[model samples]
Target: MPRVSTDQLAARRQQILDGARACFARYGYEGATVRRLEQTTGLSRGAIFHHYRDKDALFLALAEQDAGRMADVVAEQGLVQVMRDLLAHPPATDPASADESSWLGTRLEISRRLRTEPEFRQRWSSHSAELTRATRERLERQRRAGTLRDDVPVAVLAQYLELVLEGLVSHLAMGLPADDLEPVLDLVEAGVRRR
Candidate 1:
């Protein structure tokens, strides 16, 4: 083939990451091997190794990217702002796949890996804690603003919200027919209101 451009190289790398994401999602971190990644991407072993040092490197890269995205989504803004924005519009970011169940399958697989694999556990836990901290800060602001109730501790609620969001991700990934989450939002709005 003709020589590729920088853009081409970047795209190729993303393509490999995308392929690796799917592969890693299907197979656990330990179960997902470089050879399997090679076959999945249809790239030679050298090509795969050239892009990634090894399976741990590849898994870490994927985890970092995904965890960062999750954090961004969680602590995106103060709880009030996020709720207002979400209520104002449906989620702009749809799952990558049209098939709903497949989205959950991949996420569930990754979650499994995060729990079972020590390597994944450390990265995921760290990122999750970061998200909780950021969210707690935002929630504290909301509480001070008189928007959030005092019944629940900000830190506890932040962690609770994270868990709820994880479920939301699973629900959205599953691609159930009713994509609207207004009802869920309504419940949350009610629960957080000052008594």
Candidate 2:
């Protein structure tokens, strides 16, 4: 067997993640069977499993990737912008055409899994904590800058923002009207901003 370069290995791993993302998005966790994953990824089960131990591990990788991205958004733009991004890009019927569909699908699936699968929830707590930490750090920066309200503790503000994000996600997942949420998000942002 020939040795693969580091870049090649990284690229192959990324390919699996990308294909698995679309597969999982199109069909929820339970629906994305090994065969479907193979077909979508254009790689045999052996190849896919080489990168991930099993289906659950593969899904966790995808979810973790999303969490990292969300944490980046929180660190840079605040958590509200994450919700705004969801509103900005409505879920597309075509998964290939719209990134938001994959994102929303993953989020919806994560929410479902968290509620029904205690093991998954346990595995996910650390990743979830990363997002919370990012939110708190951002809030702390704002406080230092004299922008965030001083009365509320940073931890409380982070929780509040996280809850608001969950509600927004639920609203969108339920197919509720999201067309008129800018003002609502604005109010959320304002609530934490310094008076």
Candidate 3:
């Protein structure tokens, strides 16, 4: 067979990811089977296996994408604005796509998996650390600008925000509406901001 170009390979990979995203959105993480992914992607089971070792790995890839997107937004807008934007307008997993299926429900399953799955936990920790580092940098800037209060340690505050964000994911998994988190976040911001 002739060699496939880099662009073709990337497009095919993305198509698979999109298909997986839609399948997961329509069916919960536990509910979305490899057979379901095959149907969604229009690829045979063997083909899907060629790309991912198994279901868990595929799910992790999707979760990694979500984490990266969030980290990018946080790094770009700063944690405060990201929280405010999240409060102002609810967003689906992939905002650009018109699909209503969301990854919010999937996080709960991952959170449960994290307890027993050491590899999964390690992957999650790395992603969480990246966000934490970005948030910590932003916090340092805020501290120097006199926006963050002096009472709380910057490291503690950054970790607190990270934990709060993780809790929000868990809540979303539990069917908590994103909007309901607004007041909770408001309280957190108030607690952290200088009076």
Candidate 4:
């Protein structure tokens, strides 16, 4: 009956996204049922669905938020900084830190869904493209500035960086020791730097 202001609508949408992220992280995509989402968000199914058409849409929105954050990092600081950030605050195994590491959970879920769900894979392509585009644009800038190697094409370099990022995510997701990663990352940077 009453009109909600733009700020209120945005705030409510954010509330749903934040709560849905935690719910999906704590319990994988399949596990985050409507009831769990309701409990986690402290909002009714009607409210949550009002923001998102369904669980899949909610998950996609959450993933998009993470992807956008990553793309920003890639654009401004380079993909390696994204890795550094993840290492600085590695995925949390303990419940206390789980909220902080929700992004990792979303990433892990994305990987799983991409492999098993064709429809989700199709839906996710555009988001993945943004990251690739950011990586290429960063590489192009470095190339113009004489920082990146000239022999390899920017496309190749972007793919290399994307692969490296994926590997780093897998390593971190598996709970591998990240203490020795600084030098490893240095090696990655060196691989693309001008000789």
| Clash count per candidate | 0, 0, 0, 0
Residue-level lDDT for 85 in candidate 3: 54
Over all chains combined, what TM-score does candidate 1 have?
Answer: 0.63
Off by over 4 Å in 3: 80-103, 177-180
Say which prediction, candidate 3 or candidate 4, comes out ahead on TM-score: 4
TM-score of 4: 0.92
Number of the top-ranking candidate, with lDDT as the measure: 4
Writing each residue's lDDT as its tens digit, candidate 4 over 14-85 gives: 999888888877777998999989988899999999989999999999999999999999999999888888
Between prediction 2 and prediction 3, which has the larger lDDT? 2
Per TM-score, the best of the predicted structures is 4
The deviation in Å at residue 38 for candidate 4 is: 2.2
lDDT of 3 by residue, 59-168 (tens): 88877776666667777766655565544534345423314234443445567778778888987888767778878887788889998899989999987887876766
TM-score of each prediction: 0.63, 0.91, 0.77, 0.92
**Backbone clash tally (model 4):** 0
Q: Per-residue lDDT of 96-135 in model 1, one digit per residue for the tens?
A: 3223212233445557767678876776677556656767
List per-prediction Cα lDDT, in the order shown: 0.62, 0.87, 0.71, 0.88
Worst 10 residues of 3 by lDDT: 94-103
Q: What lDDT is reached at residue 72 by model 1?
A: 65
**TM-score pick, better of 1 and 3:** 3
Give Cα distance to truth, residue 167, candidate 1, Å.
4.0
